[model samples]
Target: MPQPESQNQPIAGRYELLEEIDHGGMGSVWRGYDAVLDRPVAVKLIRQQSVTSPELAEEFVKRFKREARITARIQHPGVPQVYDAVLDESYEQLFLVMELVDGISLRSYVQPTQLLPVSWAAAVTAQVATVLSHAHAVPVIHRDLKPGNILISHDGTVKVLDFGIAAILRSDVTKLTATGTPLGTHQYMAPEQVRGGRTSPQTDLYALGCILHELLSGRLLFTADSEYMVMYQHVNAAPTPLRQLRPDVPTALEDLVLHLLRKAPEARPADVQEVYERLEPFLPSPGAQVSAPGQAGPAGVPDPTSIFRKPYAPRARAGQQSAAGQAAESATAQPAPPVPDAVRAAIKVAYSRSDALLEDDRFAQAAEVIGEVIEPAALALGSESRQVLELRMNRAAIWLLGGDYRAALPELDALSDAYARTSGPSSERARACRAQAARCRAELGQVTDALAALRDVLDVVRSVDGDVSEEAVELRRDIGMLFLAQGRTTEAHNILEPLHADLCLVLGPDDEMTSEIAEVLAVIRLDLDGPPS
Candidate 1:
C-alpha cells in the first residue's frame, strides 16, 4: 500500500515524503510525515508511467475513496487507520496517507526465523484472523494477503495492512484481447483467483493457509520461477503438506491450514472467524506467556524480521543467481508449450467483442459467439487449455444476460469445481467463479441459493486484486429486486437505497442502474402499501 517516491513531492500541500520505502510492479511507497496531523506517516505515490487510461484514473479515484470509506469503517486496532486520501494534479498520482508502522513485514520475519514455533505462528495468525473476520464482516477482501502485507510492530502488535488496492494499479494490460482476467501475487493466490472467478471469505482463508504453511515449514506452498508459473501453480497445483516439512507441527493446526488450502472454496472454512475458532483454543491469549499460547517468542523477542520477502519471491533457490536463472527459465516457458498461432487467431475472433455485443443487446448472439464460436475455436486449440476456460467465462456472462441462467450452470458449476483444483480455494478467479455460480443459482429461483450468491458477491469484492467492477453495482441492483420479488420489503429497501445512491454517483441520475433502482423502490413502496419501508 505504501508507494515510494512520495518523499520528494509535497502531497496535496500537506504531507511530504522523506524517502522511498519500497517499490513494486504496481507502484512505490514512501516514509513521510503529515504536516497537518503533526505525526509520522506513510504515503503511496502511484507511478506516472503506470497510469495508462482515463477510465483507470477515474477508477483510481473511486477505489481510493472506497478504501478511505471502507477501511475507515474498521476500527480494528490490528488494522492501520487510514489518515487521508490525497489526489491532486490532474488526478494522475494519488498519495494515500496512512498510519506509519515501524516494523518488519511478516514475510521478512519468517525467513531467518524459518518455521516459526507453531504457538507463535498460531497467535499471530489468530490476531490476523481476528482482523480478517471484521474486515470480511464489512465484506472487504484484501486480494493480496501475503506475508509482506502483514506487519509485526515493535510492541508485538500484528497489523494487516495494504488491503485490496494493489490490483487497481496492475491489471491485465497485456490481456486486452485475451479472454482471461489478470491475477494477484500468484504464490499466495487461491485457486479460484487464477481462473478469473469470484472470491469470498474463503479466498482469504486460503491465503491464511498459505501463510500458515510457510510459517510452519519455512517454505512456500507453491514453487514456480516466474509470475506466470506461480499463477499456473495457483490454477493447477496441489499444495505440499505442512508436516512434510516439519513432522511435529500440530496435527490440528496442520489440518486447519490444509482445510483452508482445499481445492474448492466450498470445502474451506466460511470466514476468518472460522479460521480463528479453529486455531484459537490452542493459542495463548494476547500478552500471555509466549510458550503457553504457542507463540514463537514474545512478540518481538525472536523477531519476525527476515522471515520472508515482500510480495514474496515465488520460489526459493540456493543463491540469488540461481533464483534469477530459474525466473528467466520460467518466464521463457510460459502457458507451457506456447499457445499455437491458429488457436490464438481463433480465440481472438471468438472472444474479443464482448462490450460491443452487450451494447447491441444481442445477448444470445454473444453467447453463441462465446459458447459456439469462441469456445469451439478454443477447444479446437485444446479443450483443456487455459484459453478454453478463459473463453468459457465470456460465455457465462452471456448466459447471465440472456436469462438462460441454467444453461450457464454447466460452465459456471464446472468452472467453480475446476478452479478449486487449479487455483486452490482462495484465488480471486476461484472466488469469482463461486460468485458467478451464486448469481446463476439466484437466477434459477433457488432463493436460499441466490441469497448465498449475492452474499458471496459481497464477500468476493472484498478480495484483493479482484475485478468486481460494474458487477458490484449490478449485484446490488439485482439483490434489491430479488428481495422485492420475494416480498422481503425491509431487505429490498436496504439493498436498493445504497444501490440508488451509488448509481447516482457513478452513472448520474439519467443512467439505467439509477433509473432501474428508482423504479424498484417505487414498486417496493406500492407493495408495502403505505410507507416506502
Candidate 2:
C-alpha cells in the first residue's frame, strides 16, 4: 500500500514528484515532471516492505538497478523508454523514472459488454509479440505479464510497463528472485512459474496466452476462492478451448491461444515471432477497411493495427500519382450473398441440438454444431441480421457455459450492440444482455468495468422492479465480488455486508445465494479486521 506523500518534492535534483497515478503490491507509480528534460515521466517508488533485512535490502537494490539497466536495453516501441533509475544515499527508497504513457491500462478493455474486435485484439497481441521478440533478443524475461502491466496509449500503441521483476539472462548475475518462491501474479502465472521452475521466454509466452485469452473472452483463464487454488489450476488444469466459448473465433486463432497456454513451456509457441506470424492473418491488412456498420468502432482511439497496416502512413502528396493508388481505385469489392431459407432451417435445428448438447456439458459438440451453421447463417441473413446475431449470441452463451470466455466475449458484445439497435438501449432485454456481458468482464478480471456495468444495470433493474428484486440482488452481489477482486476490501465489505443481511431476511438464512454472500462477507470482515497478531 502506498502512503500519500506530499507533492512538489524533487528527487535527485531533477525529477519532481507530482501525484500518484497508480499503486500495486510492489509500489506506487507517480506522475512526475522531469525538470532537466522538461517532460512528464512516470516515477515508480519501489516498496521497501519487499525486503526484510539490511543485507537483503542492499542486494535487492543492486538487483533492481541491474534489472532496470537491462530493461533499458530492450529497444522497442511497445516498451516504455526507460529514463533513469535512482537509489538514494539512505537506501530507504528506490525510484525508476520512465516515459509516462498517456493511456489506459489494458484491464479497462477486458469488458464483456464492449469487447474489442477480433482485429483489434489480434493487433494488440501482435504488437506485444513484436515487443517480446525484441526483449527476448536481449534475453530479458518480463517474469510478470498481466493486464495491469500493459498500457494502451492514446496513440493506439501498446506499451508494456513495469520491468521491476524482469530477470536478465546473464550467468554472472545473482538470482534475485530465489528458488521455491513464485514471483508473478497467480492468475497469469505459467505452470512452470507456479512450480518454481526455471523461467525462460516461454514463461512470458504463457502469461501472454493468459492475457490473450482474457482479452478474447473478457475473463481470466481460471479463477478460485484463493491464490493457492488459482496456482493449483495453473499447474494442473487444462484450458477450455476458445472455439467452445465463441463460435465466431477462427479455428486457427483458437488453436494459437490453446498452443500458448500449454502447461509445458516447450509445447507452447516456439517464440514471440512465431506468435506474431500466427496472428498476422487476423490483423488488418494495409489499406483494408477495419471498421464495419453495427460494430463498435475505435471511437477516436488510435488503432493499434495501423502500425503494421500503414507504417509511416502519410497524407497523399498533392497531385502525386501512384500505380498502387490507381490499382486500388480501379478495384471494387463484392458484397456477401444472402442466406437461403433452407440454410436458416438447418441453422435452427443445429442451434436446438447445441442447446441439448450444452445441457449435457458437451461444450465442444455444442459449439461445433452452432459453428457449422454460423457461416451459412451469416452469409444468407447478413452477419448483422437479428437471426444471425441470435445464432452468434447462442454460440457465445455456449462458450460462457463451457468456461471458454475468449470465444464468448466477442459474440456477447456484438449481440449487445444488436439488441440495443433493434430494441431500445434501455429495454429490459438490452439491459439483461449488457448484464451478462458485464458478468463475463468480471470473470475476466476487468473489475472496474464490471462494477460500473453491474451498478448501471442494477439501477435500471431497481427502477423497473424494486431494490430487492432477484436481478438487483444478483447485481449487488457481483459488484461486491468485483470490489473484493480489486482488493478494495472496505468497499466490498460495505456492499456485501448489507446485501448478505438483506438476502438472509428475504431469501432465508440457508438459501444458496444468501449463504454464498454470507461466506464472502465473513471473509471480507476477516480481511477488514486484519490478520491475527
**Model 2 lDDT at residue 496:** 86
- Model 2 worst lDDT window (10 residues): 316-325
The estimated TM-scores of all candidates read 0.52, 0.57
The candidate that wins on lDDT is: 2
Candidate 1 per-residue lDDT, tens place, 210-277, comes to: 98888778878888678788878766777777777788887888789888998799999877877878
The residue ranges of model 1 lying beyond 4 angstroms of the native Cα positions read 1-9, 112-114, 164-183, 285-533
Superposed by TM-score, candidate 2 places the C-alpha of residue 112 at a distance from the truth, in angstroms, of 1.5
lDDT of 2 by residue, 263-359 (tens): 9999998899999999988887777665554224334354566665676676443235344334433553543654487887898799788778666
Clashes in each model (backbone N, CA, C under 3 Å)?
A: 52, 9
Local distance difference test, each candidate: 0.68, 0.79
| Top TM-score model | 2
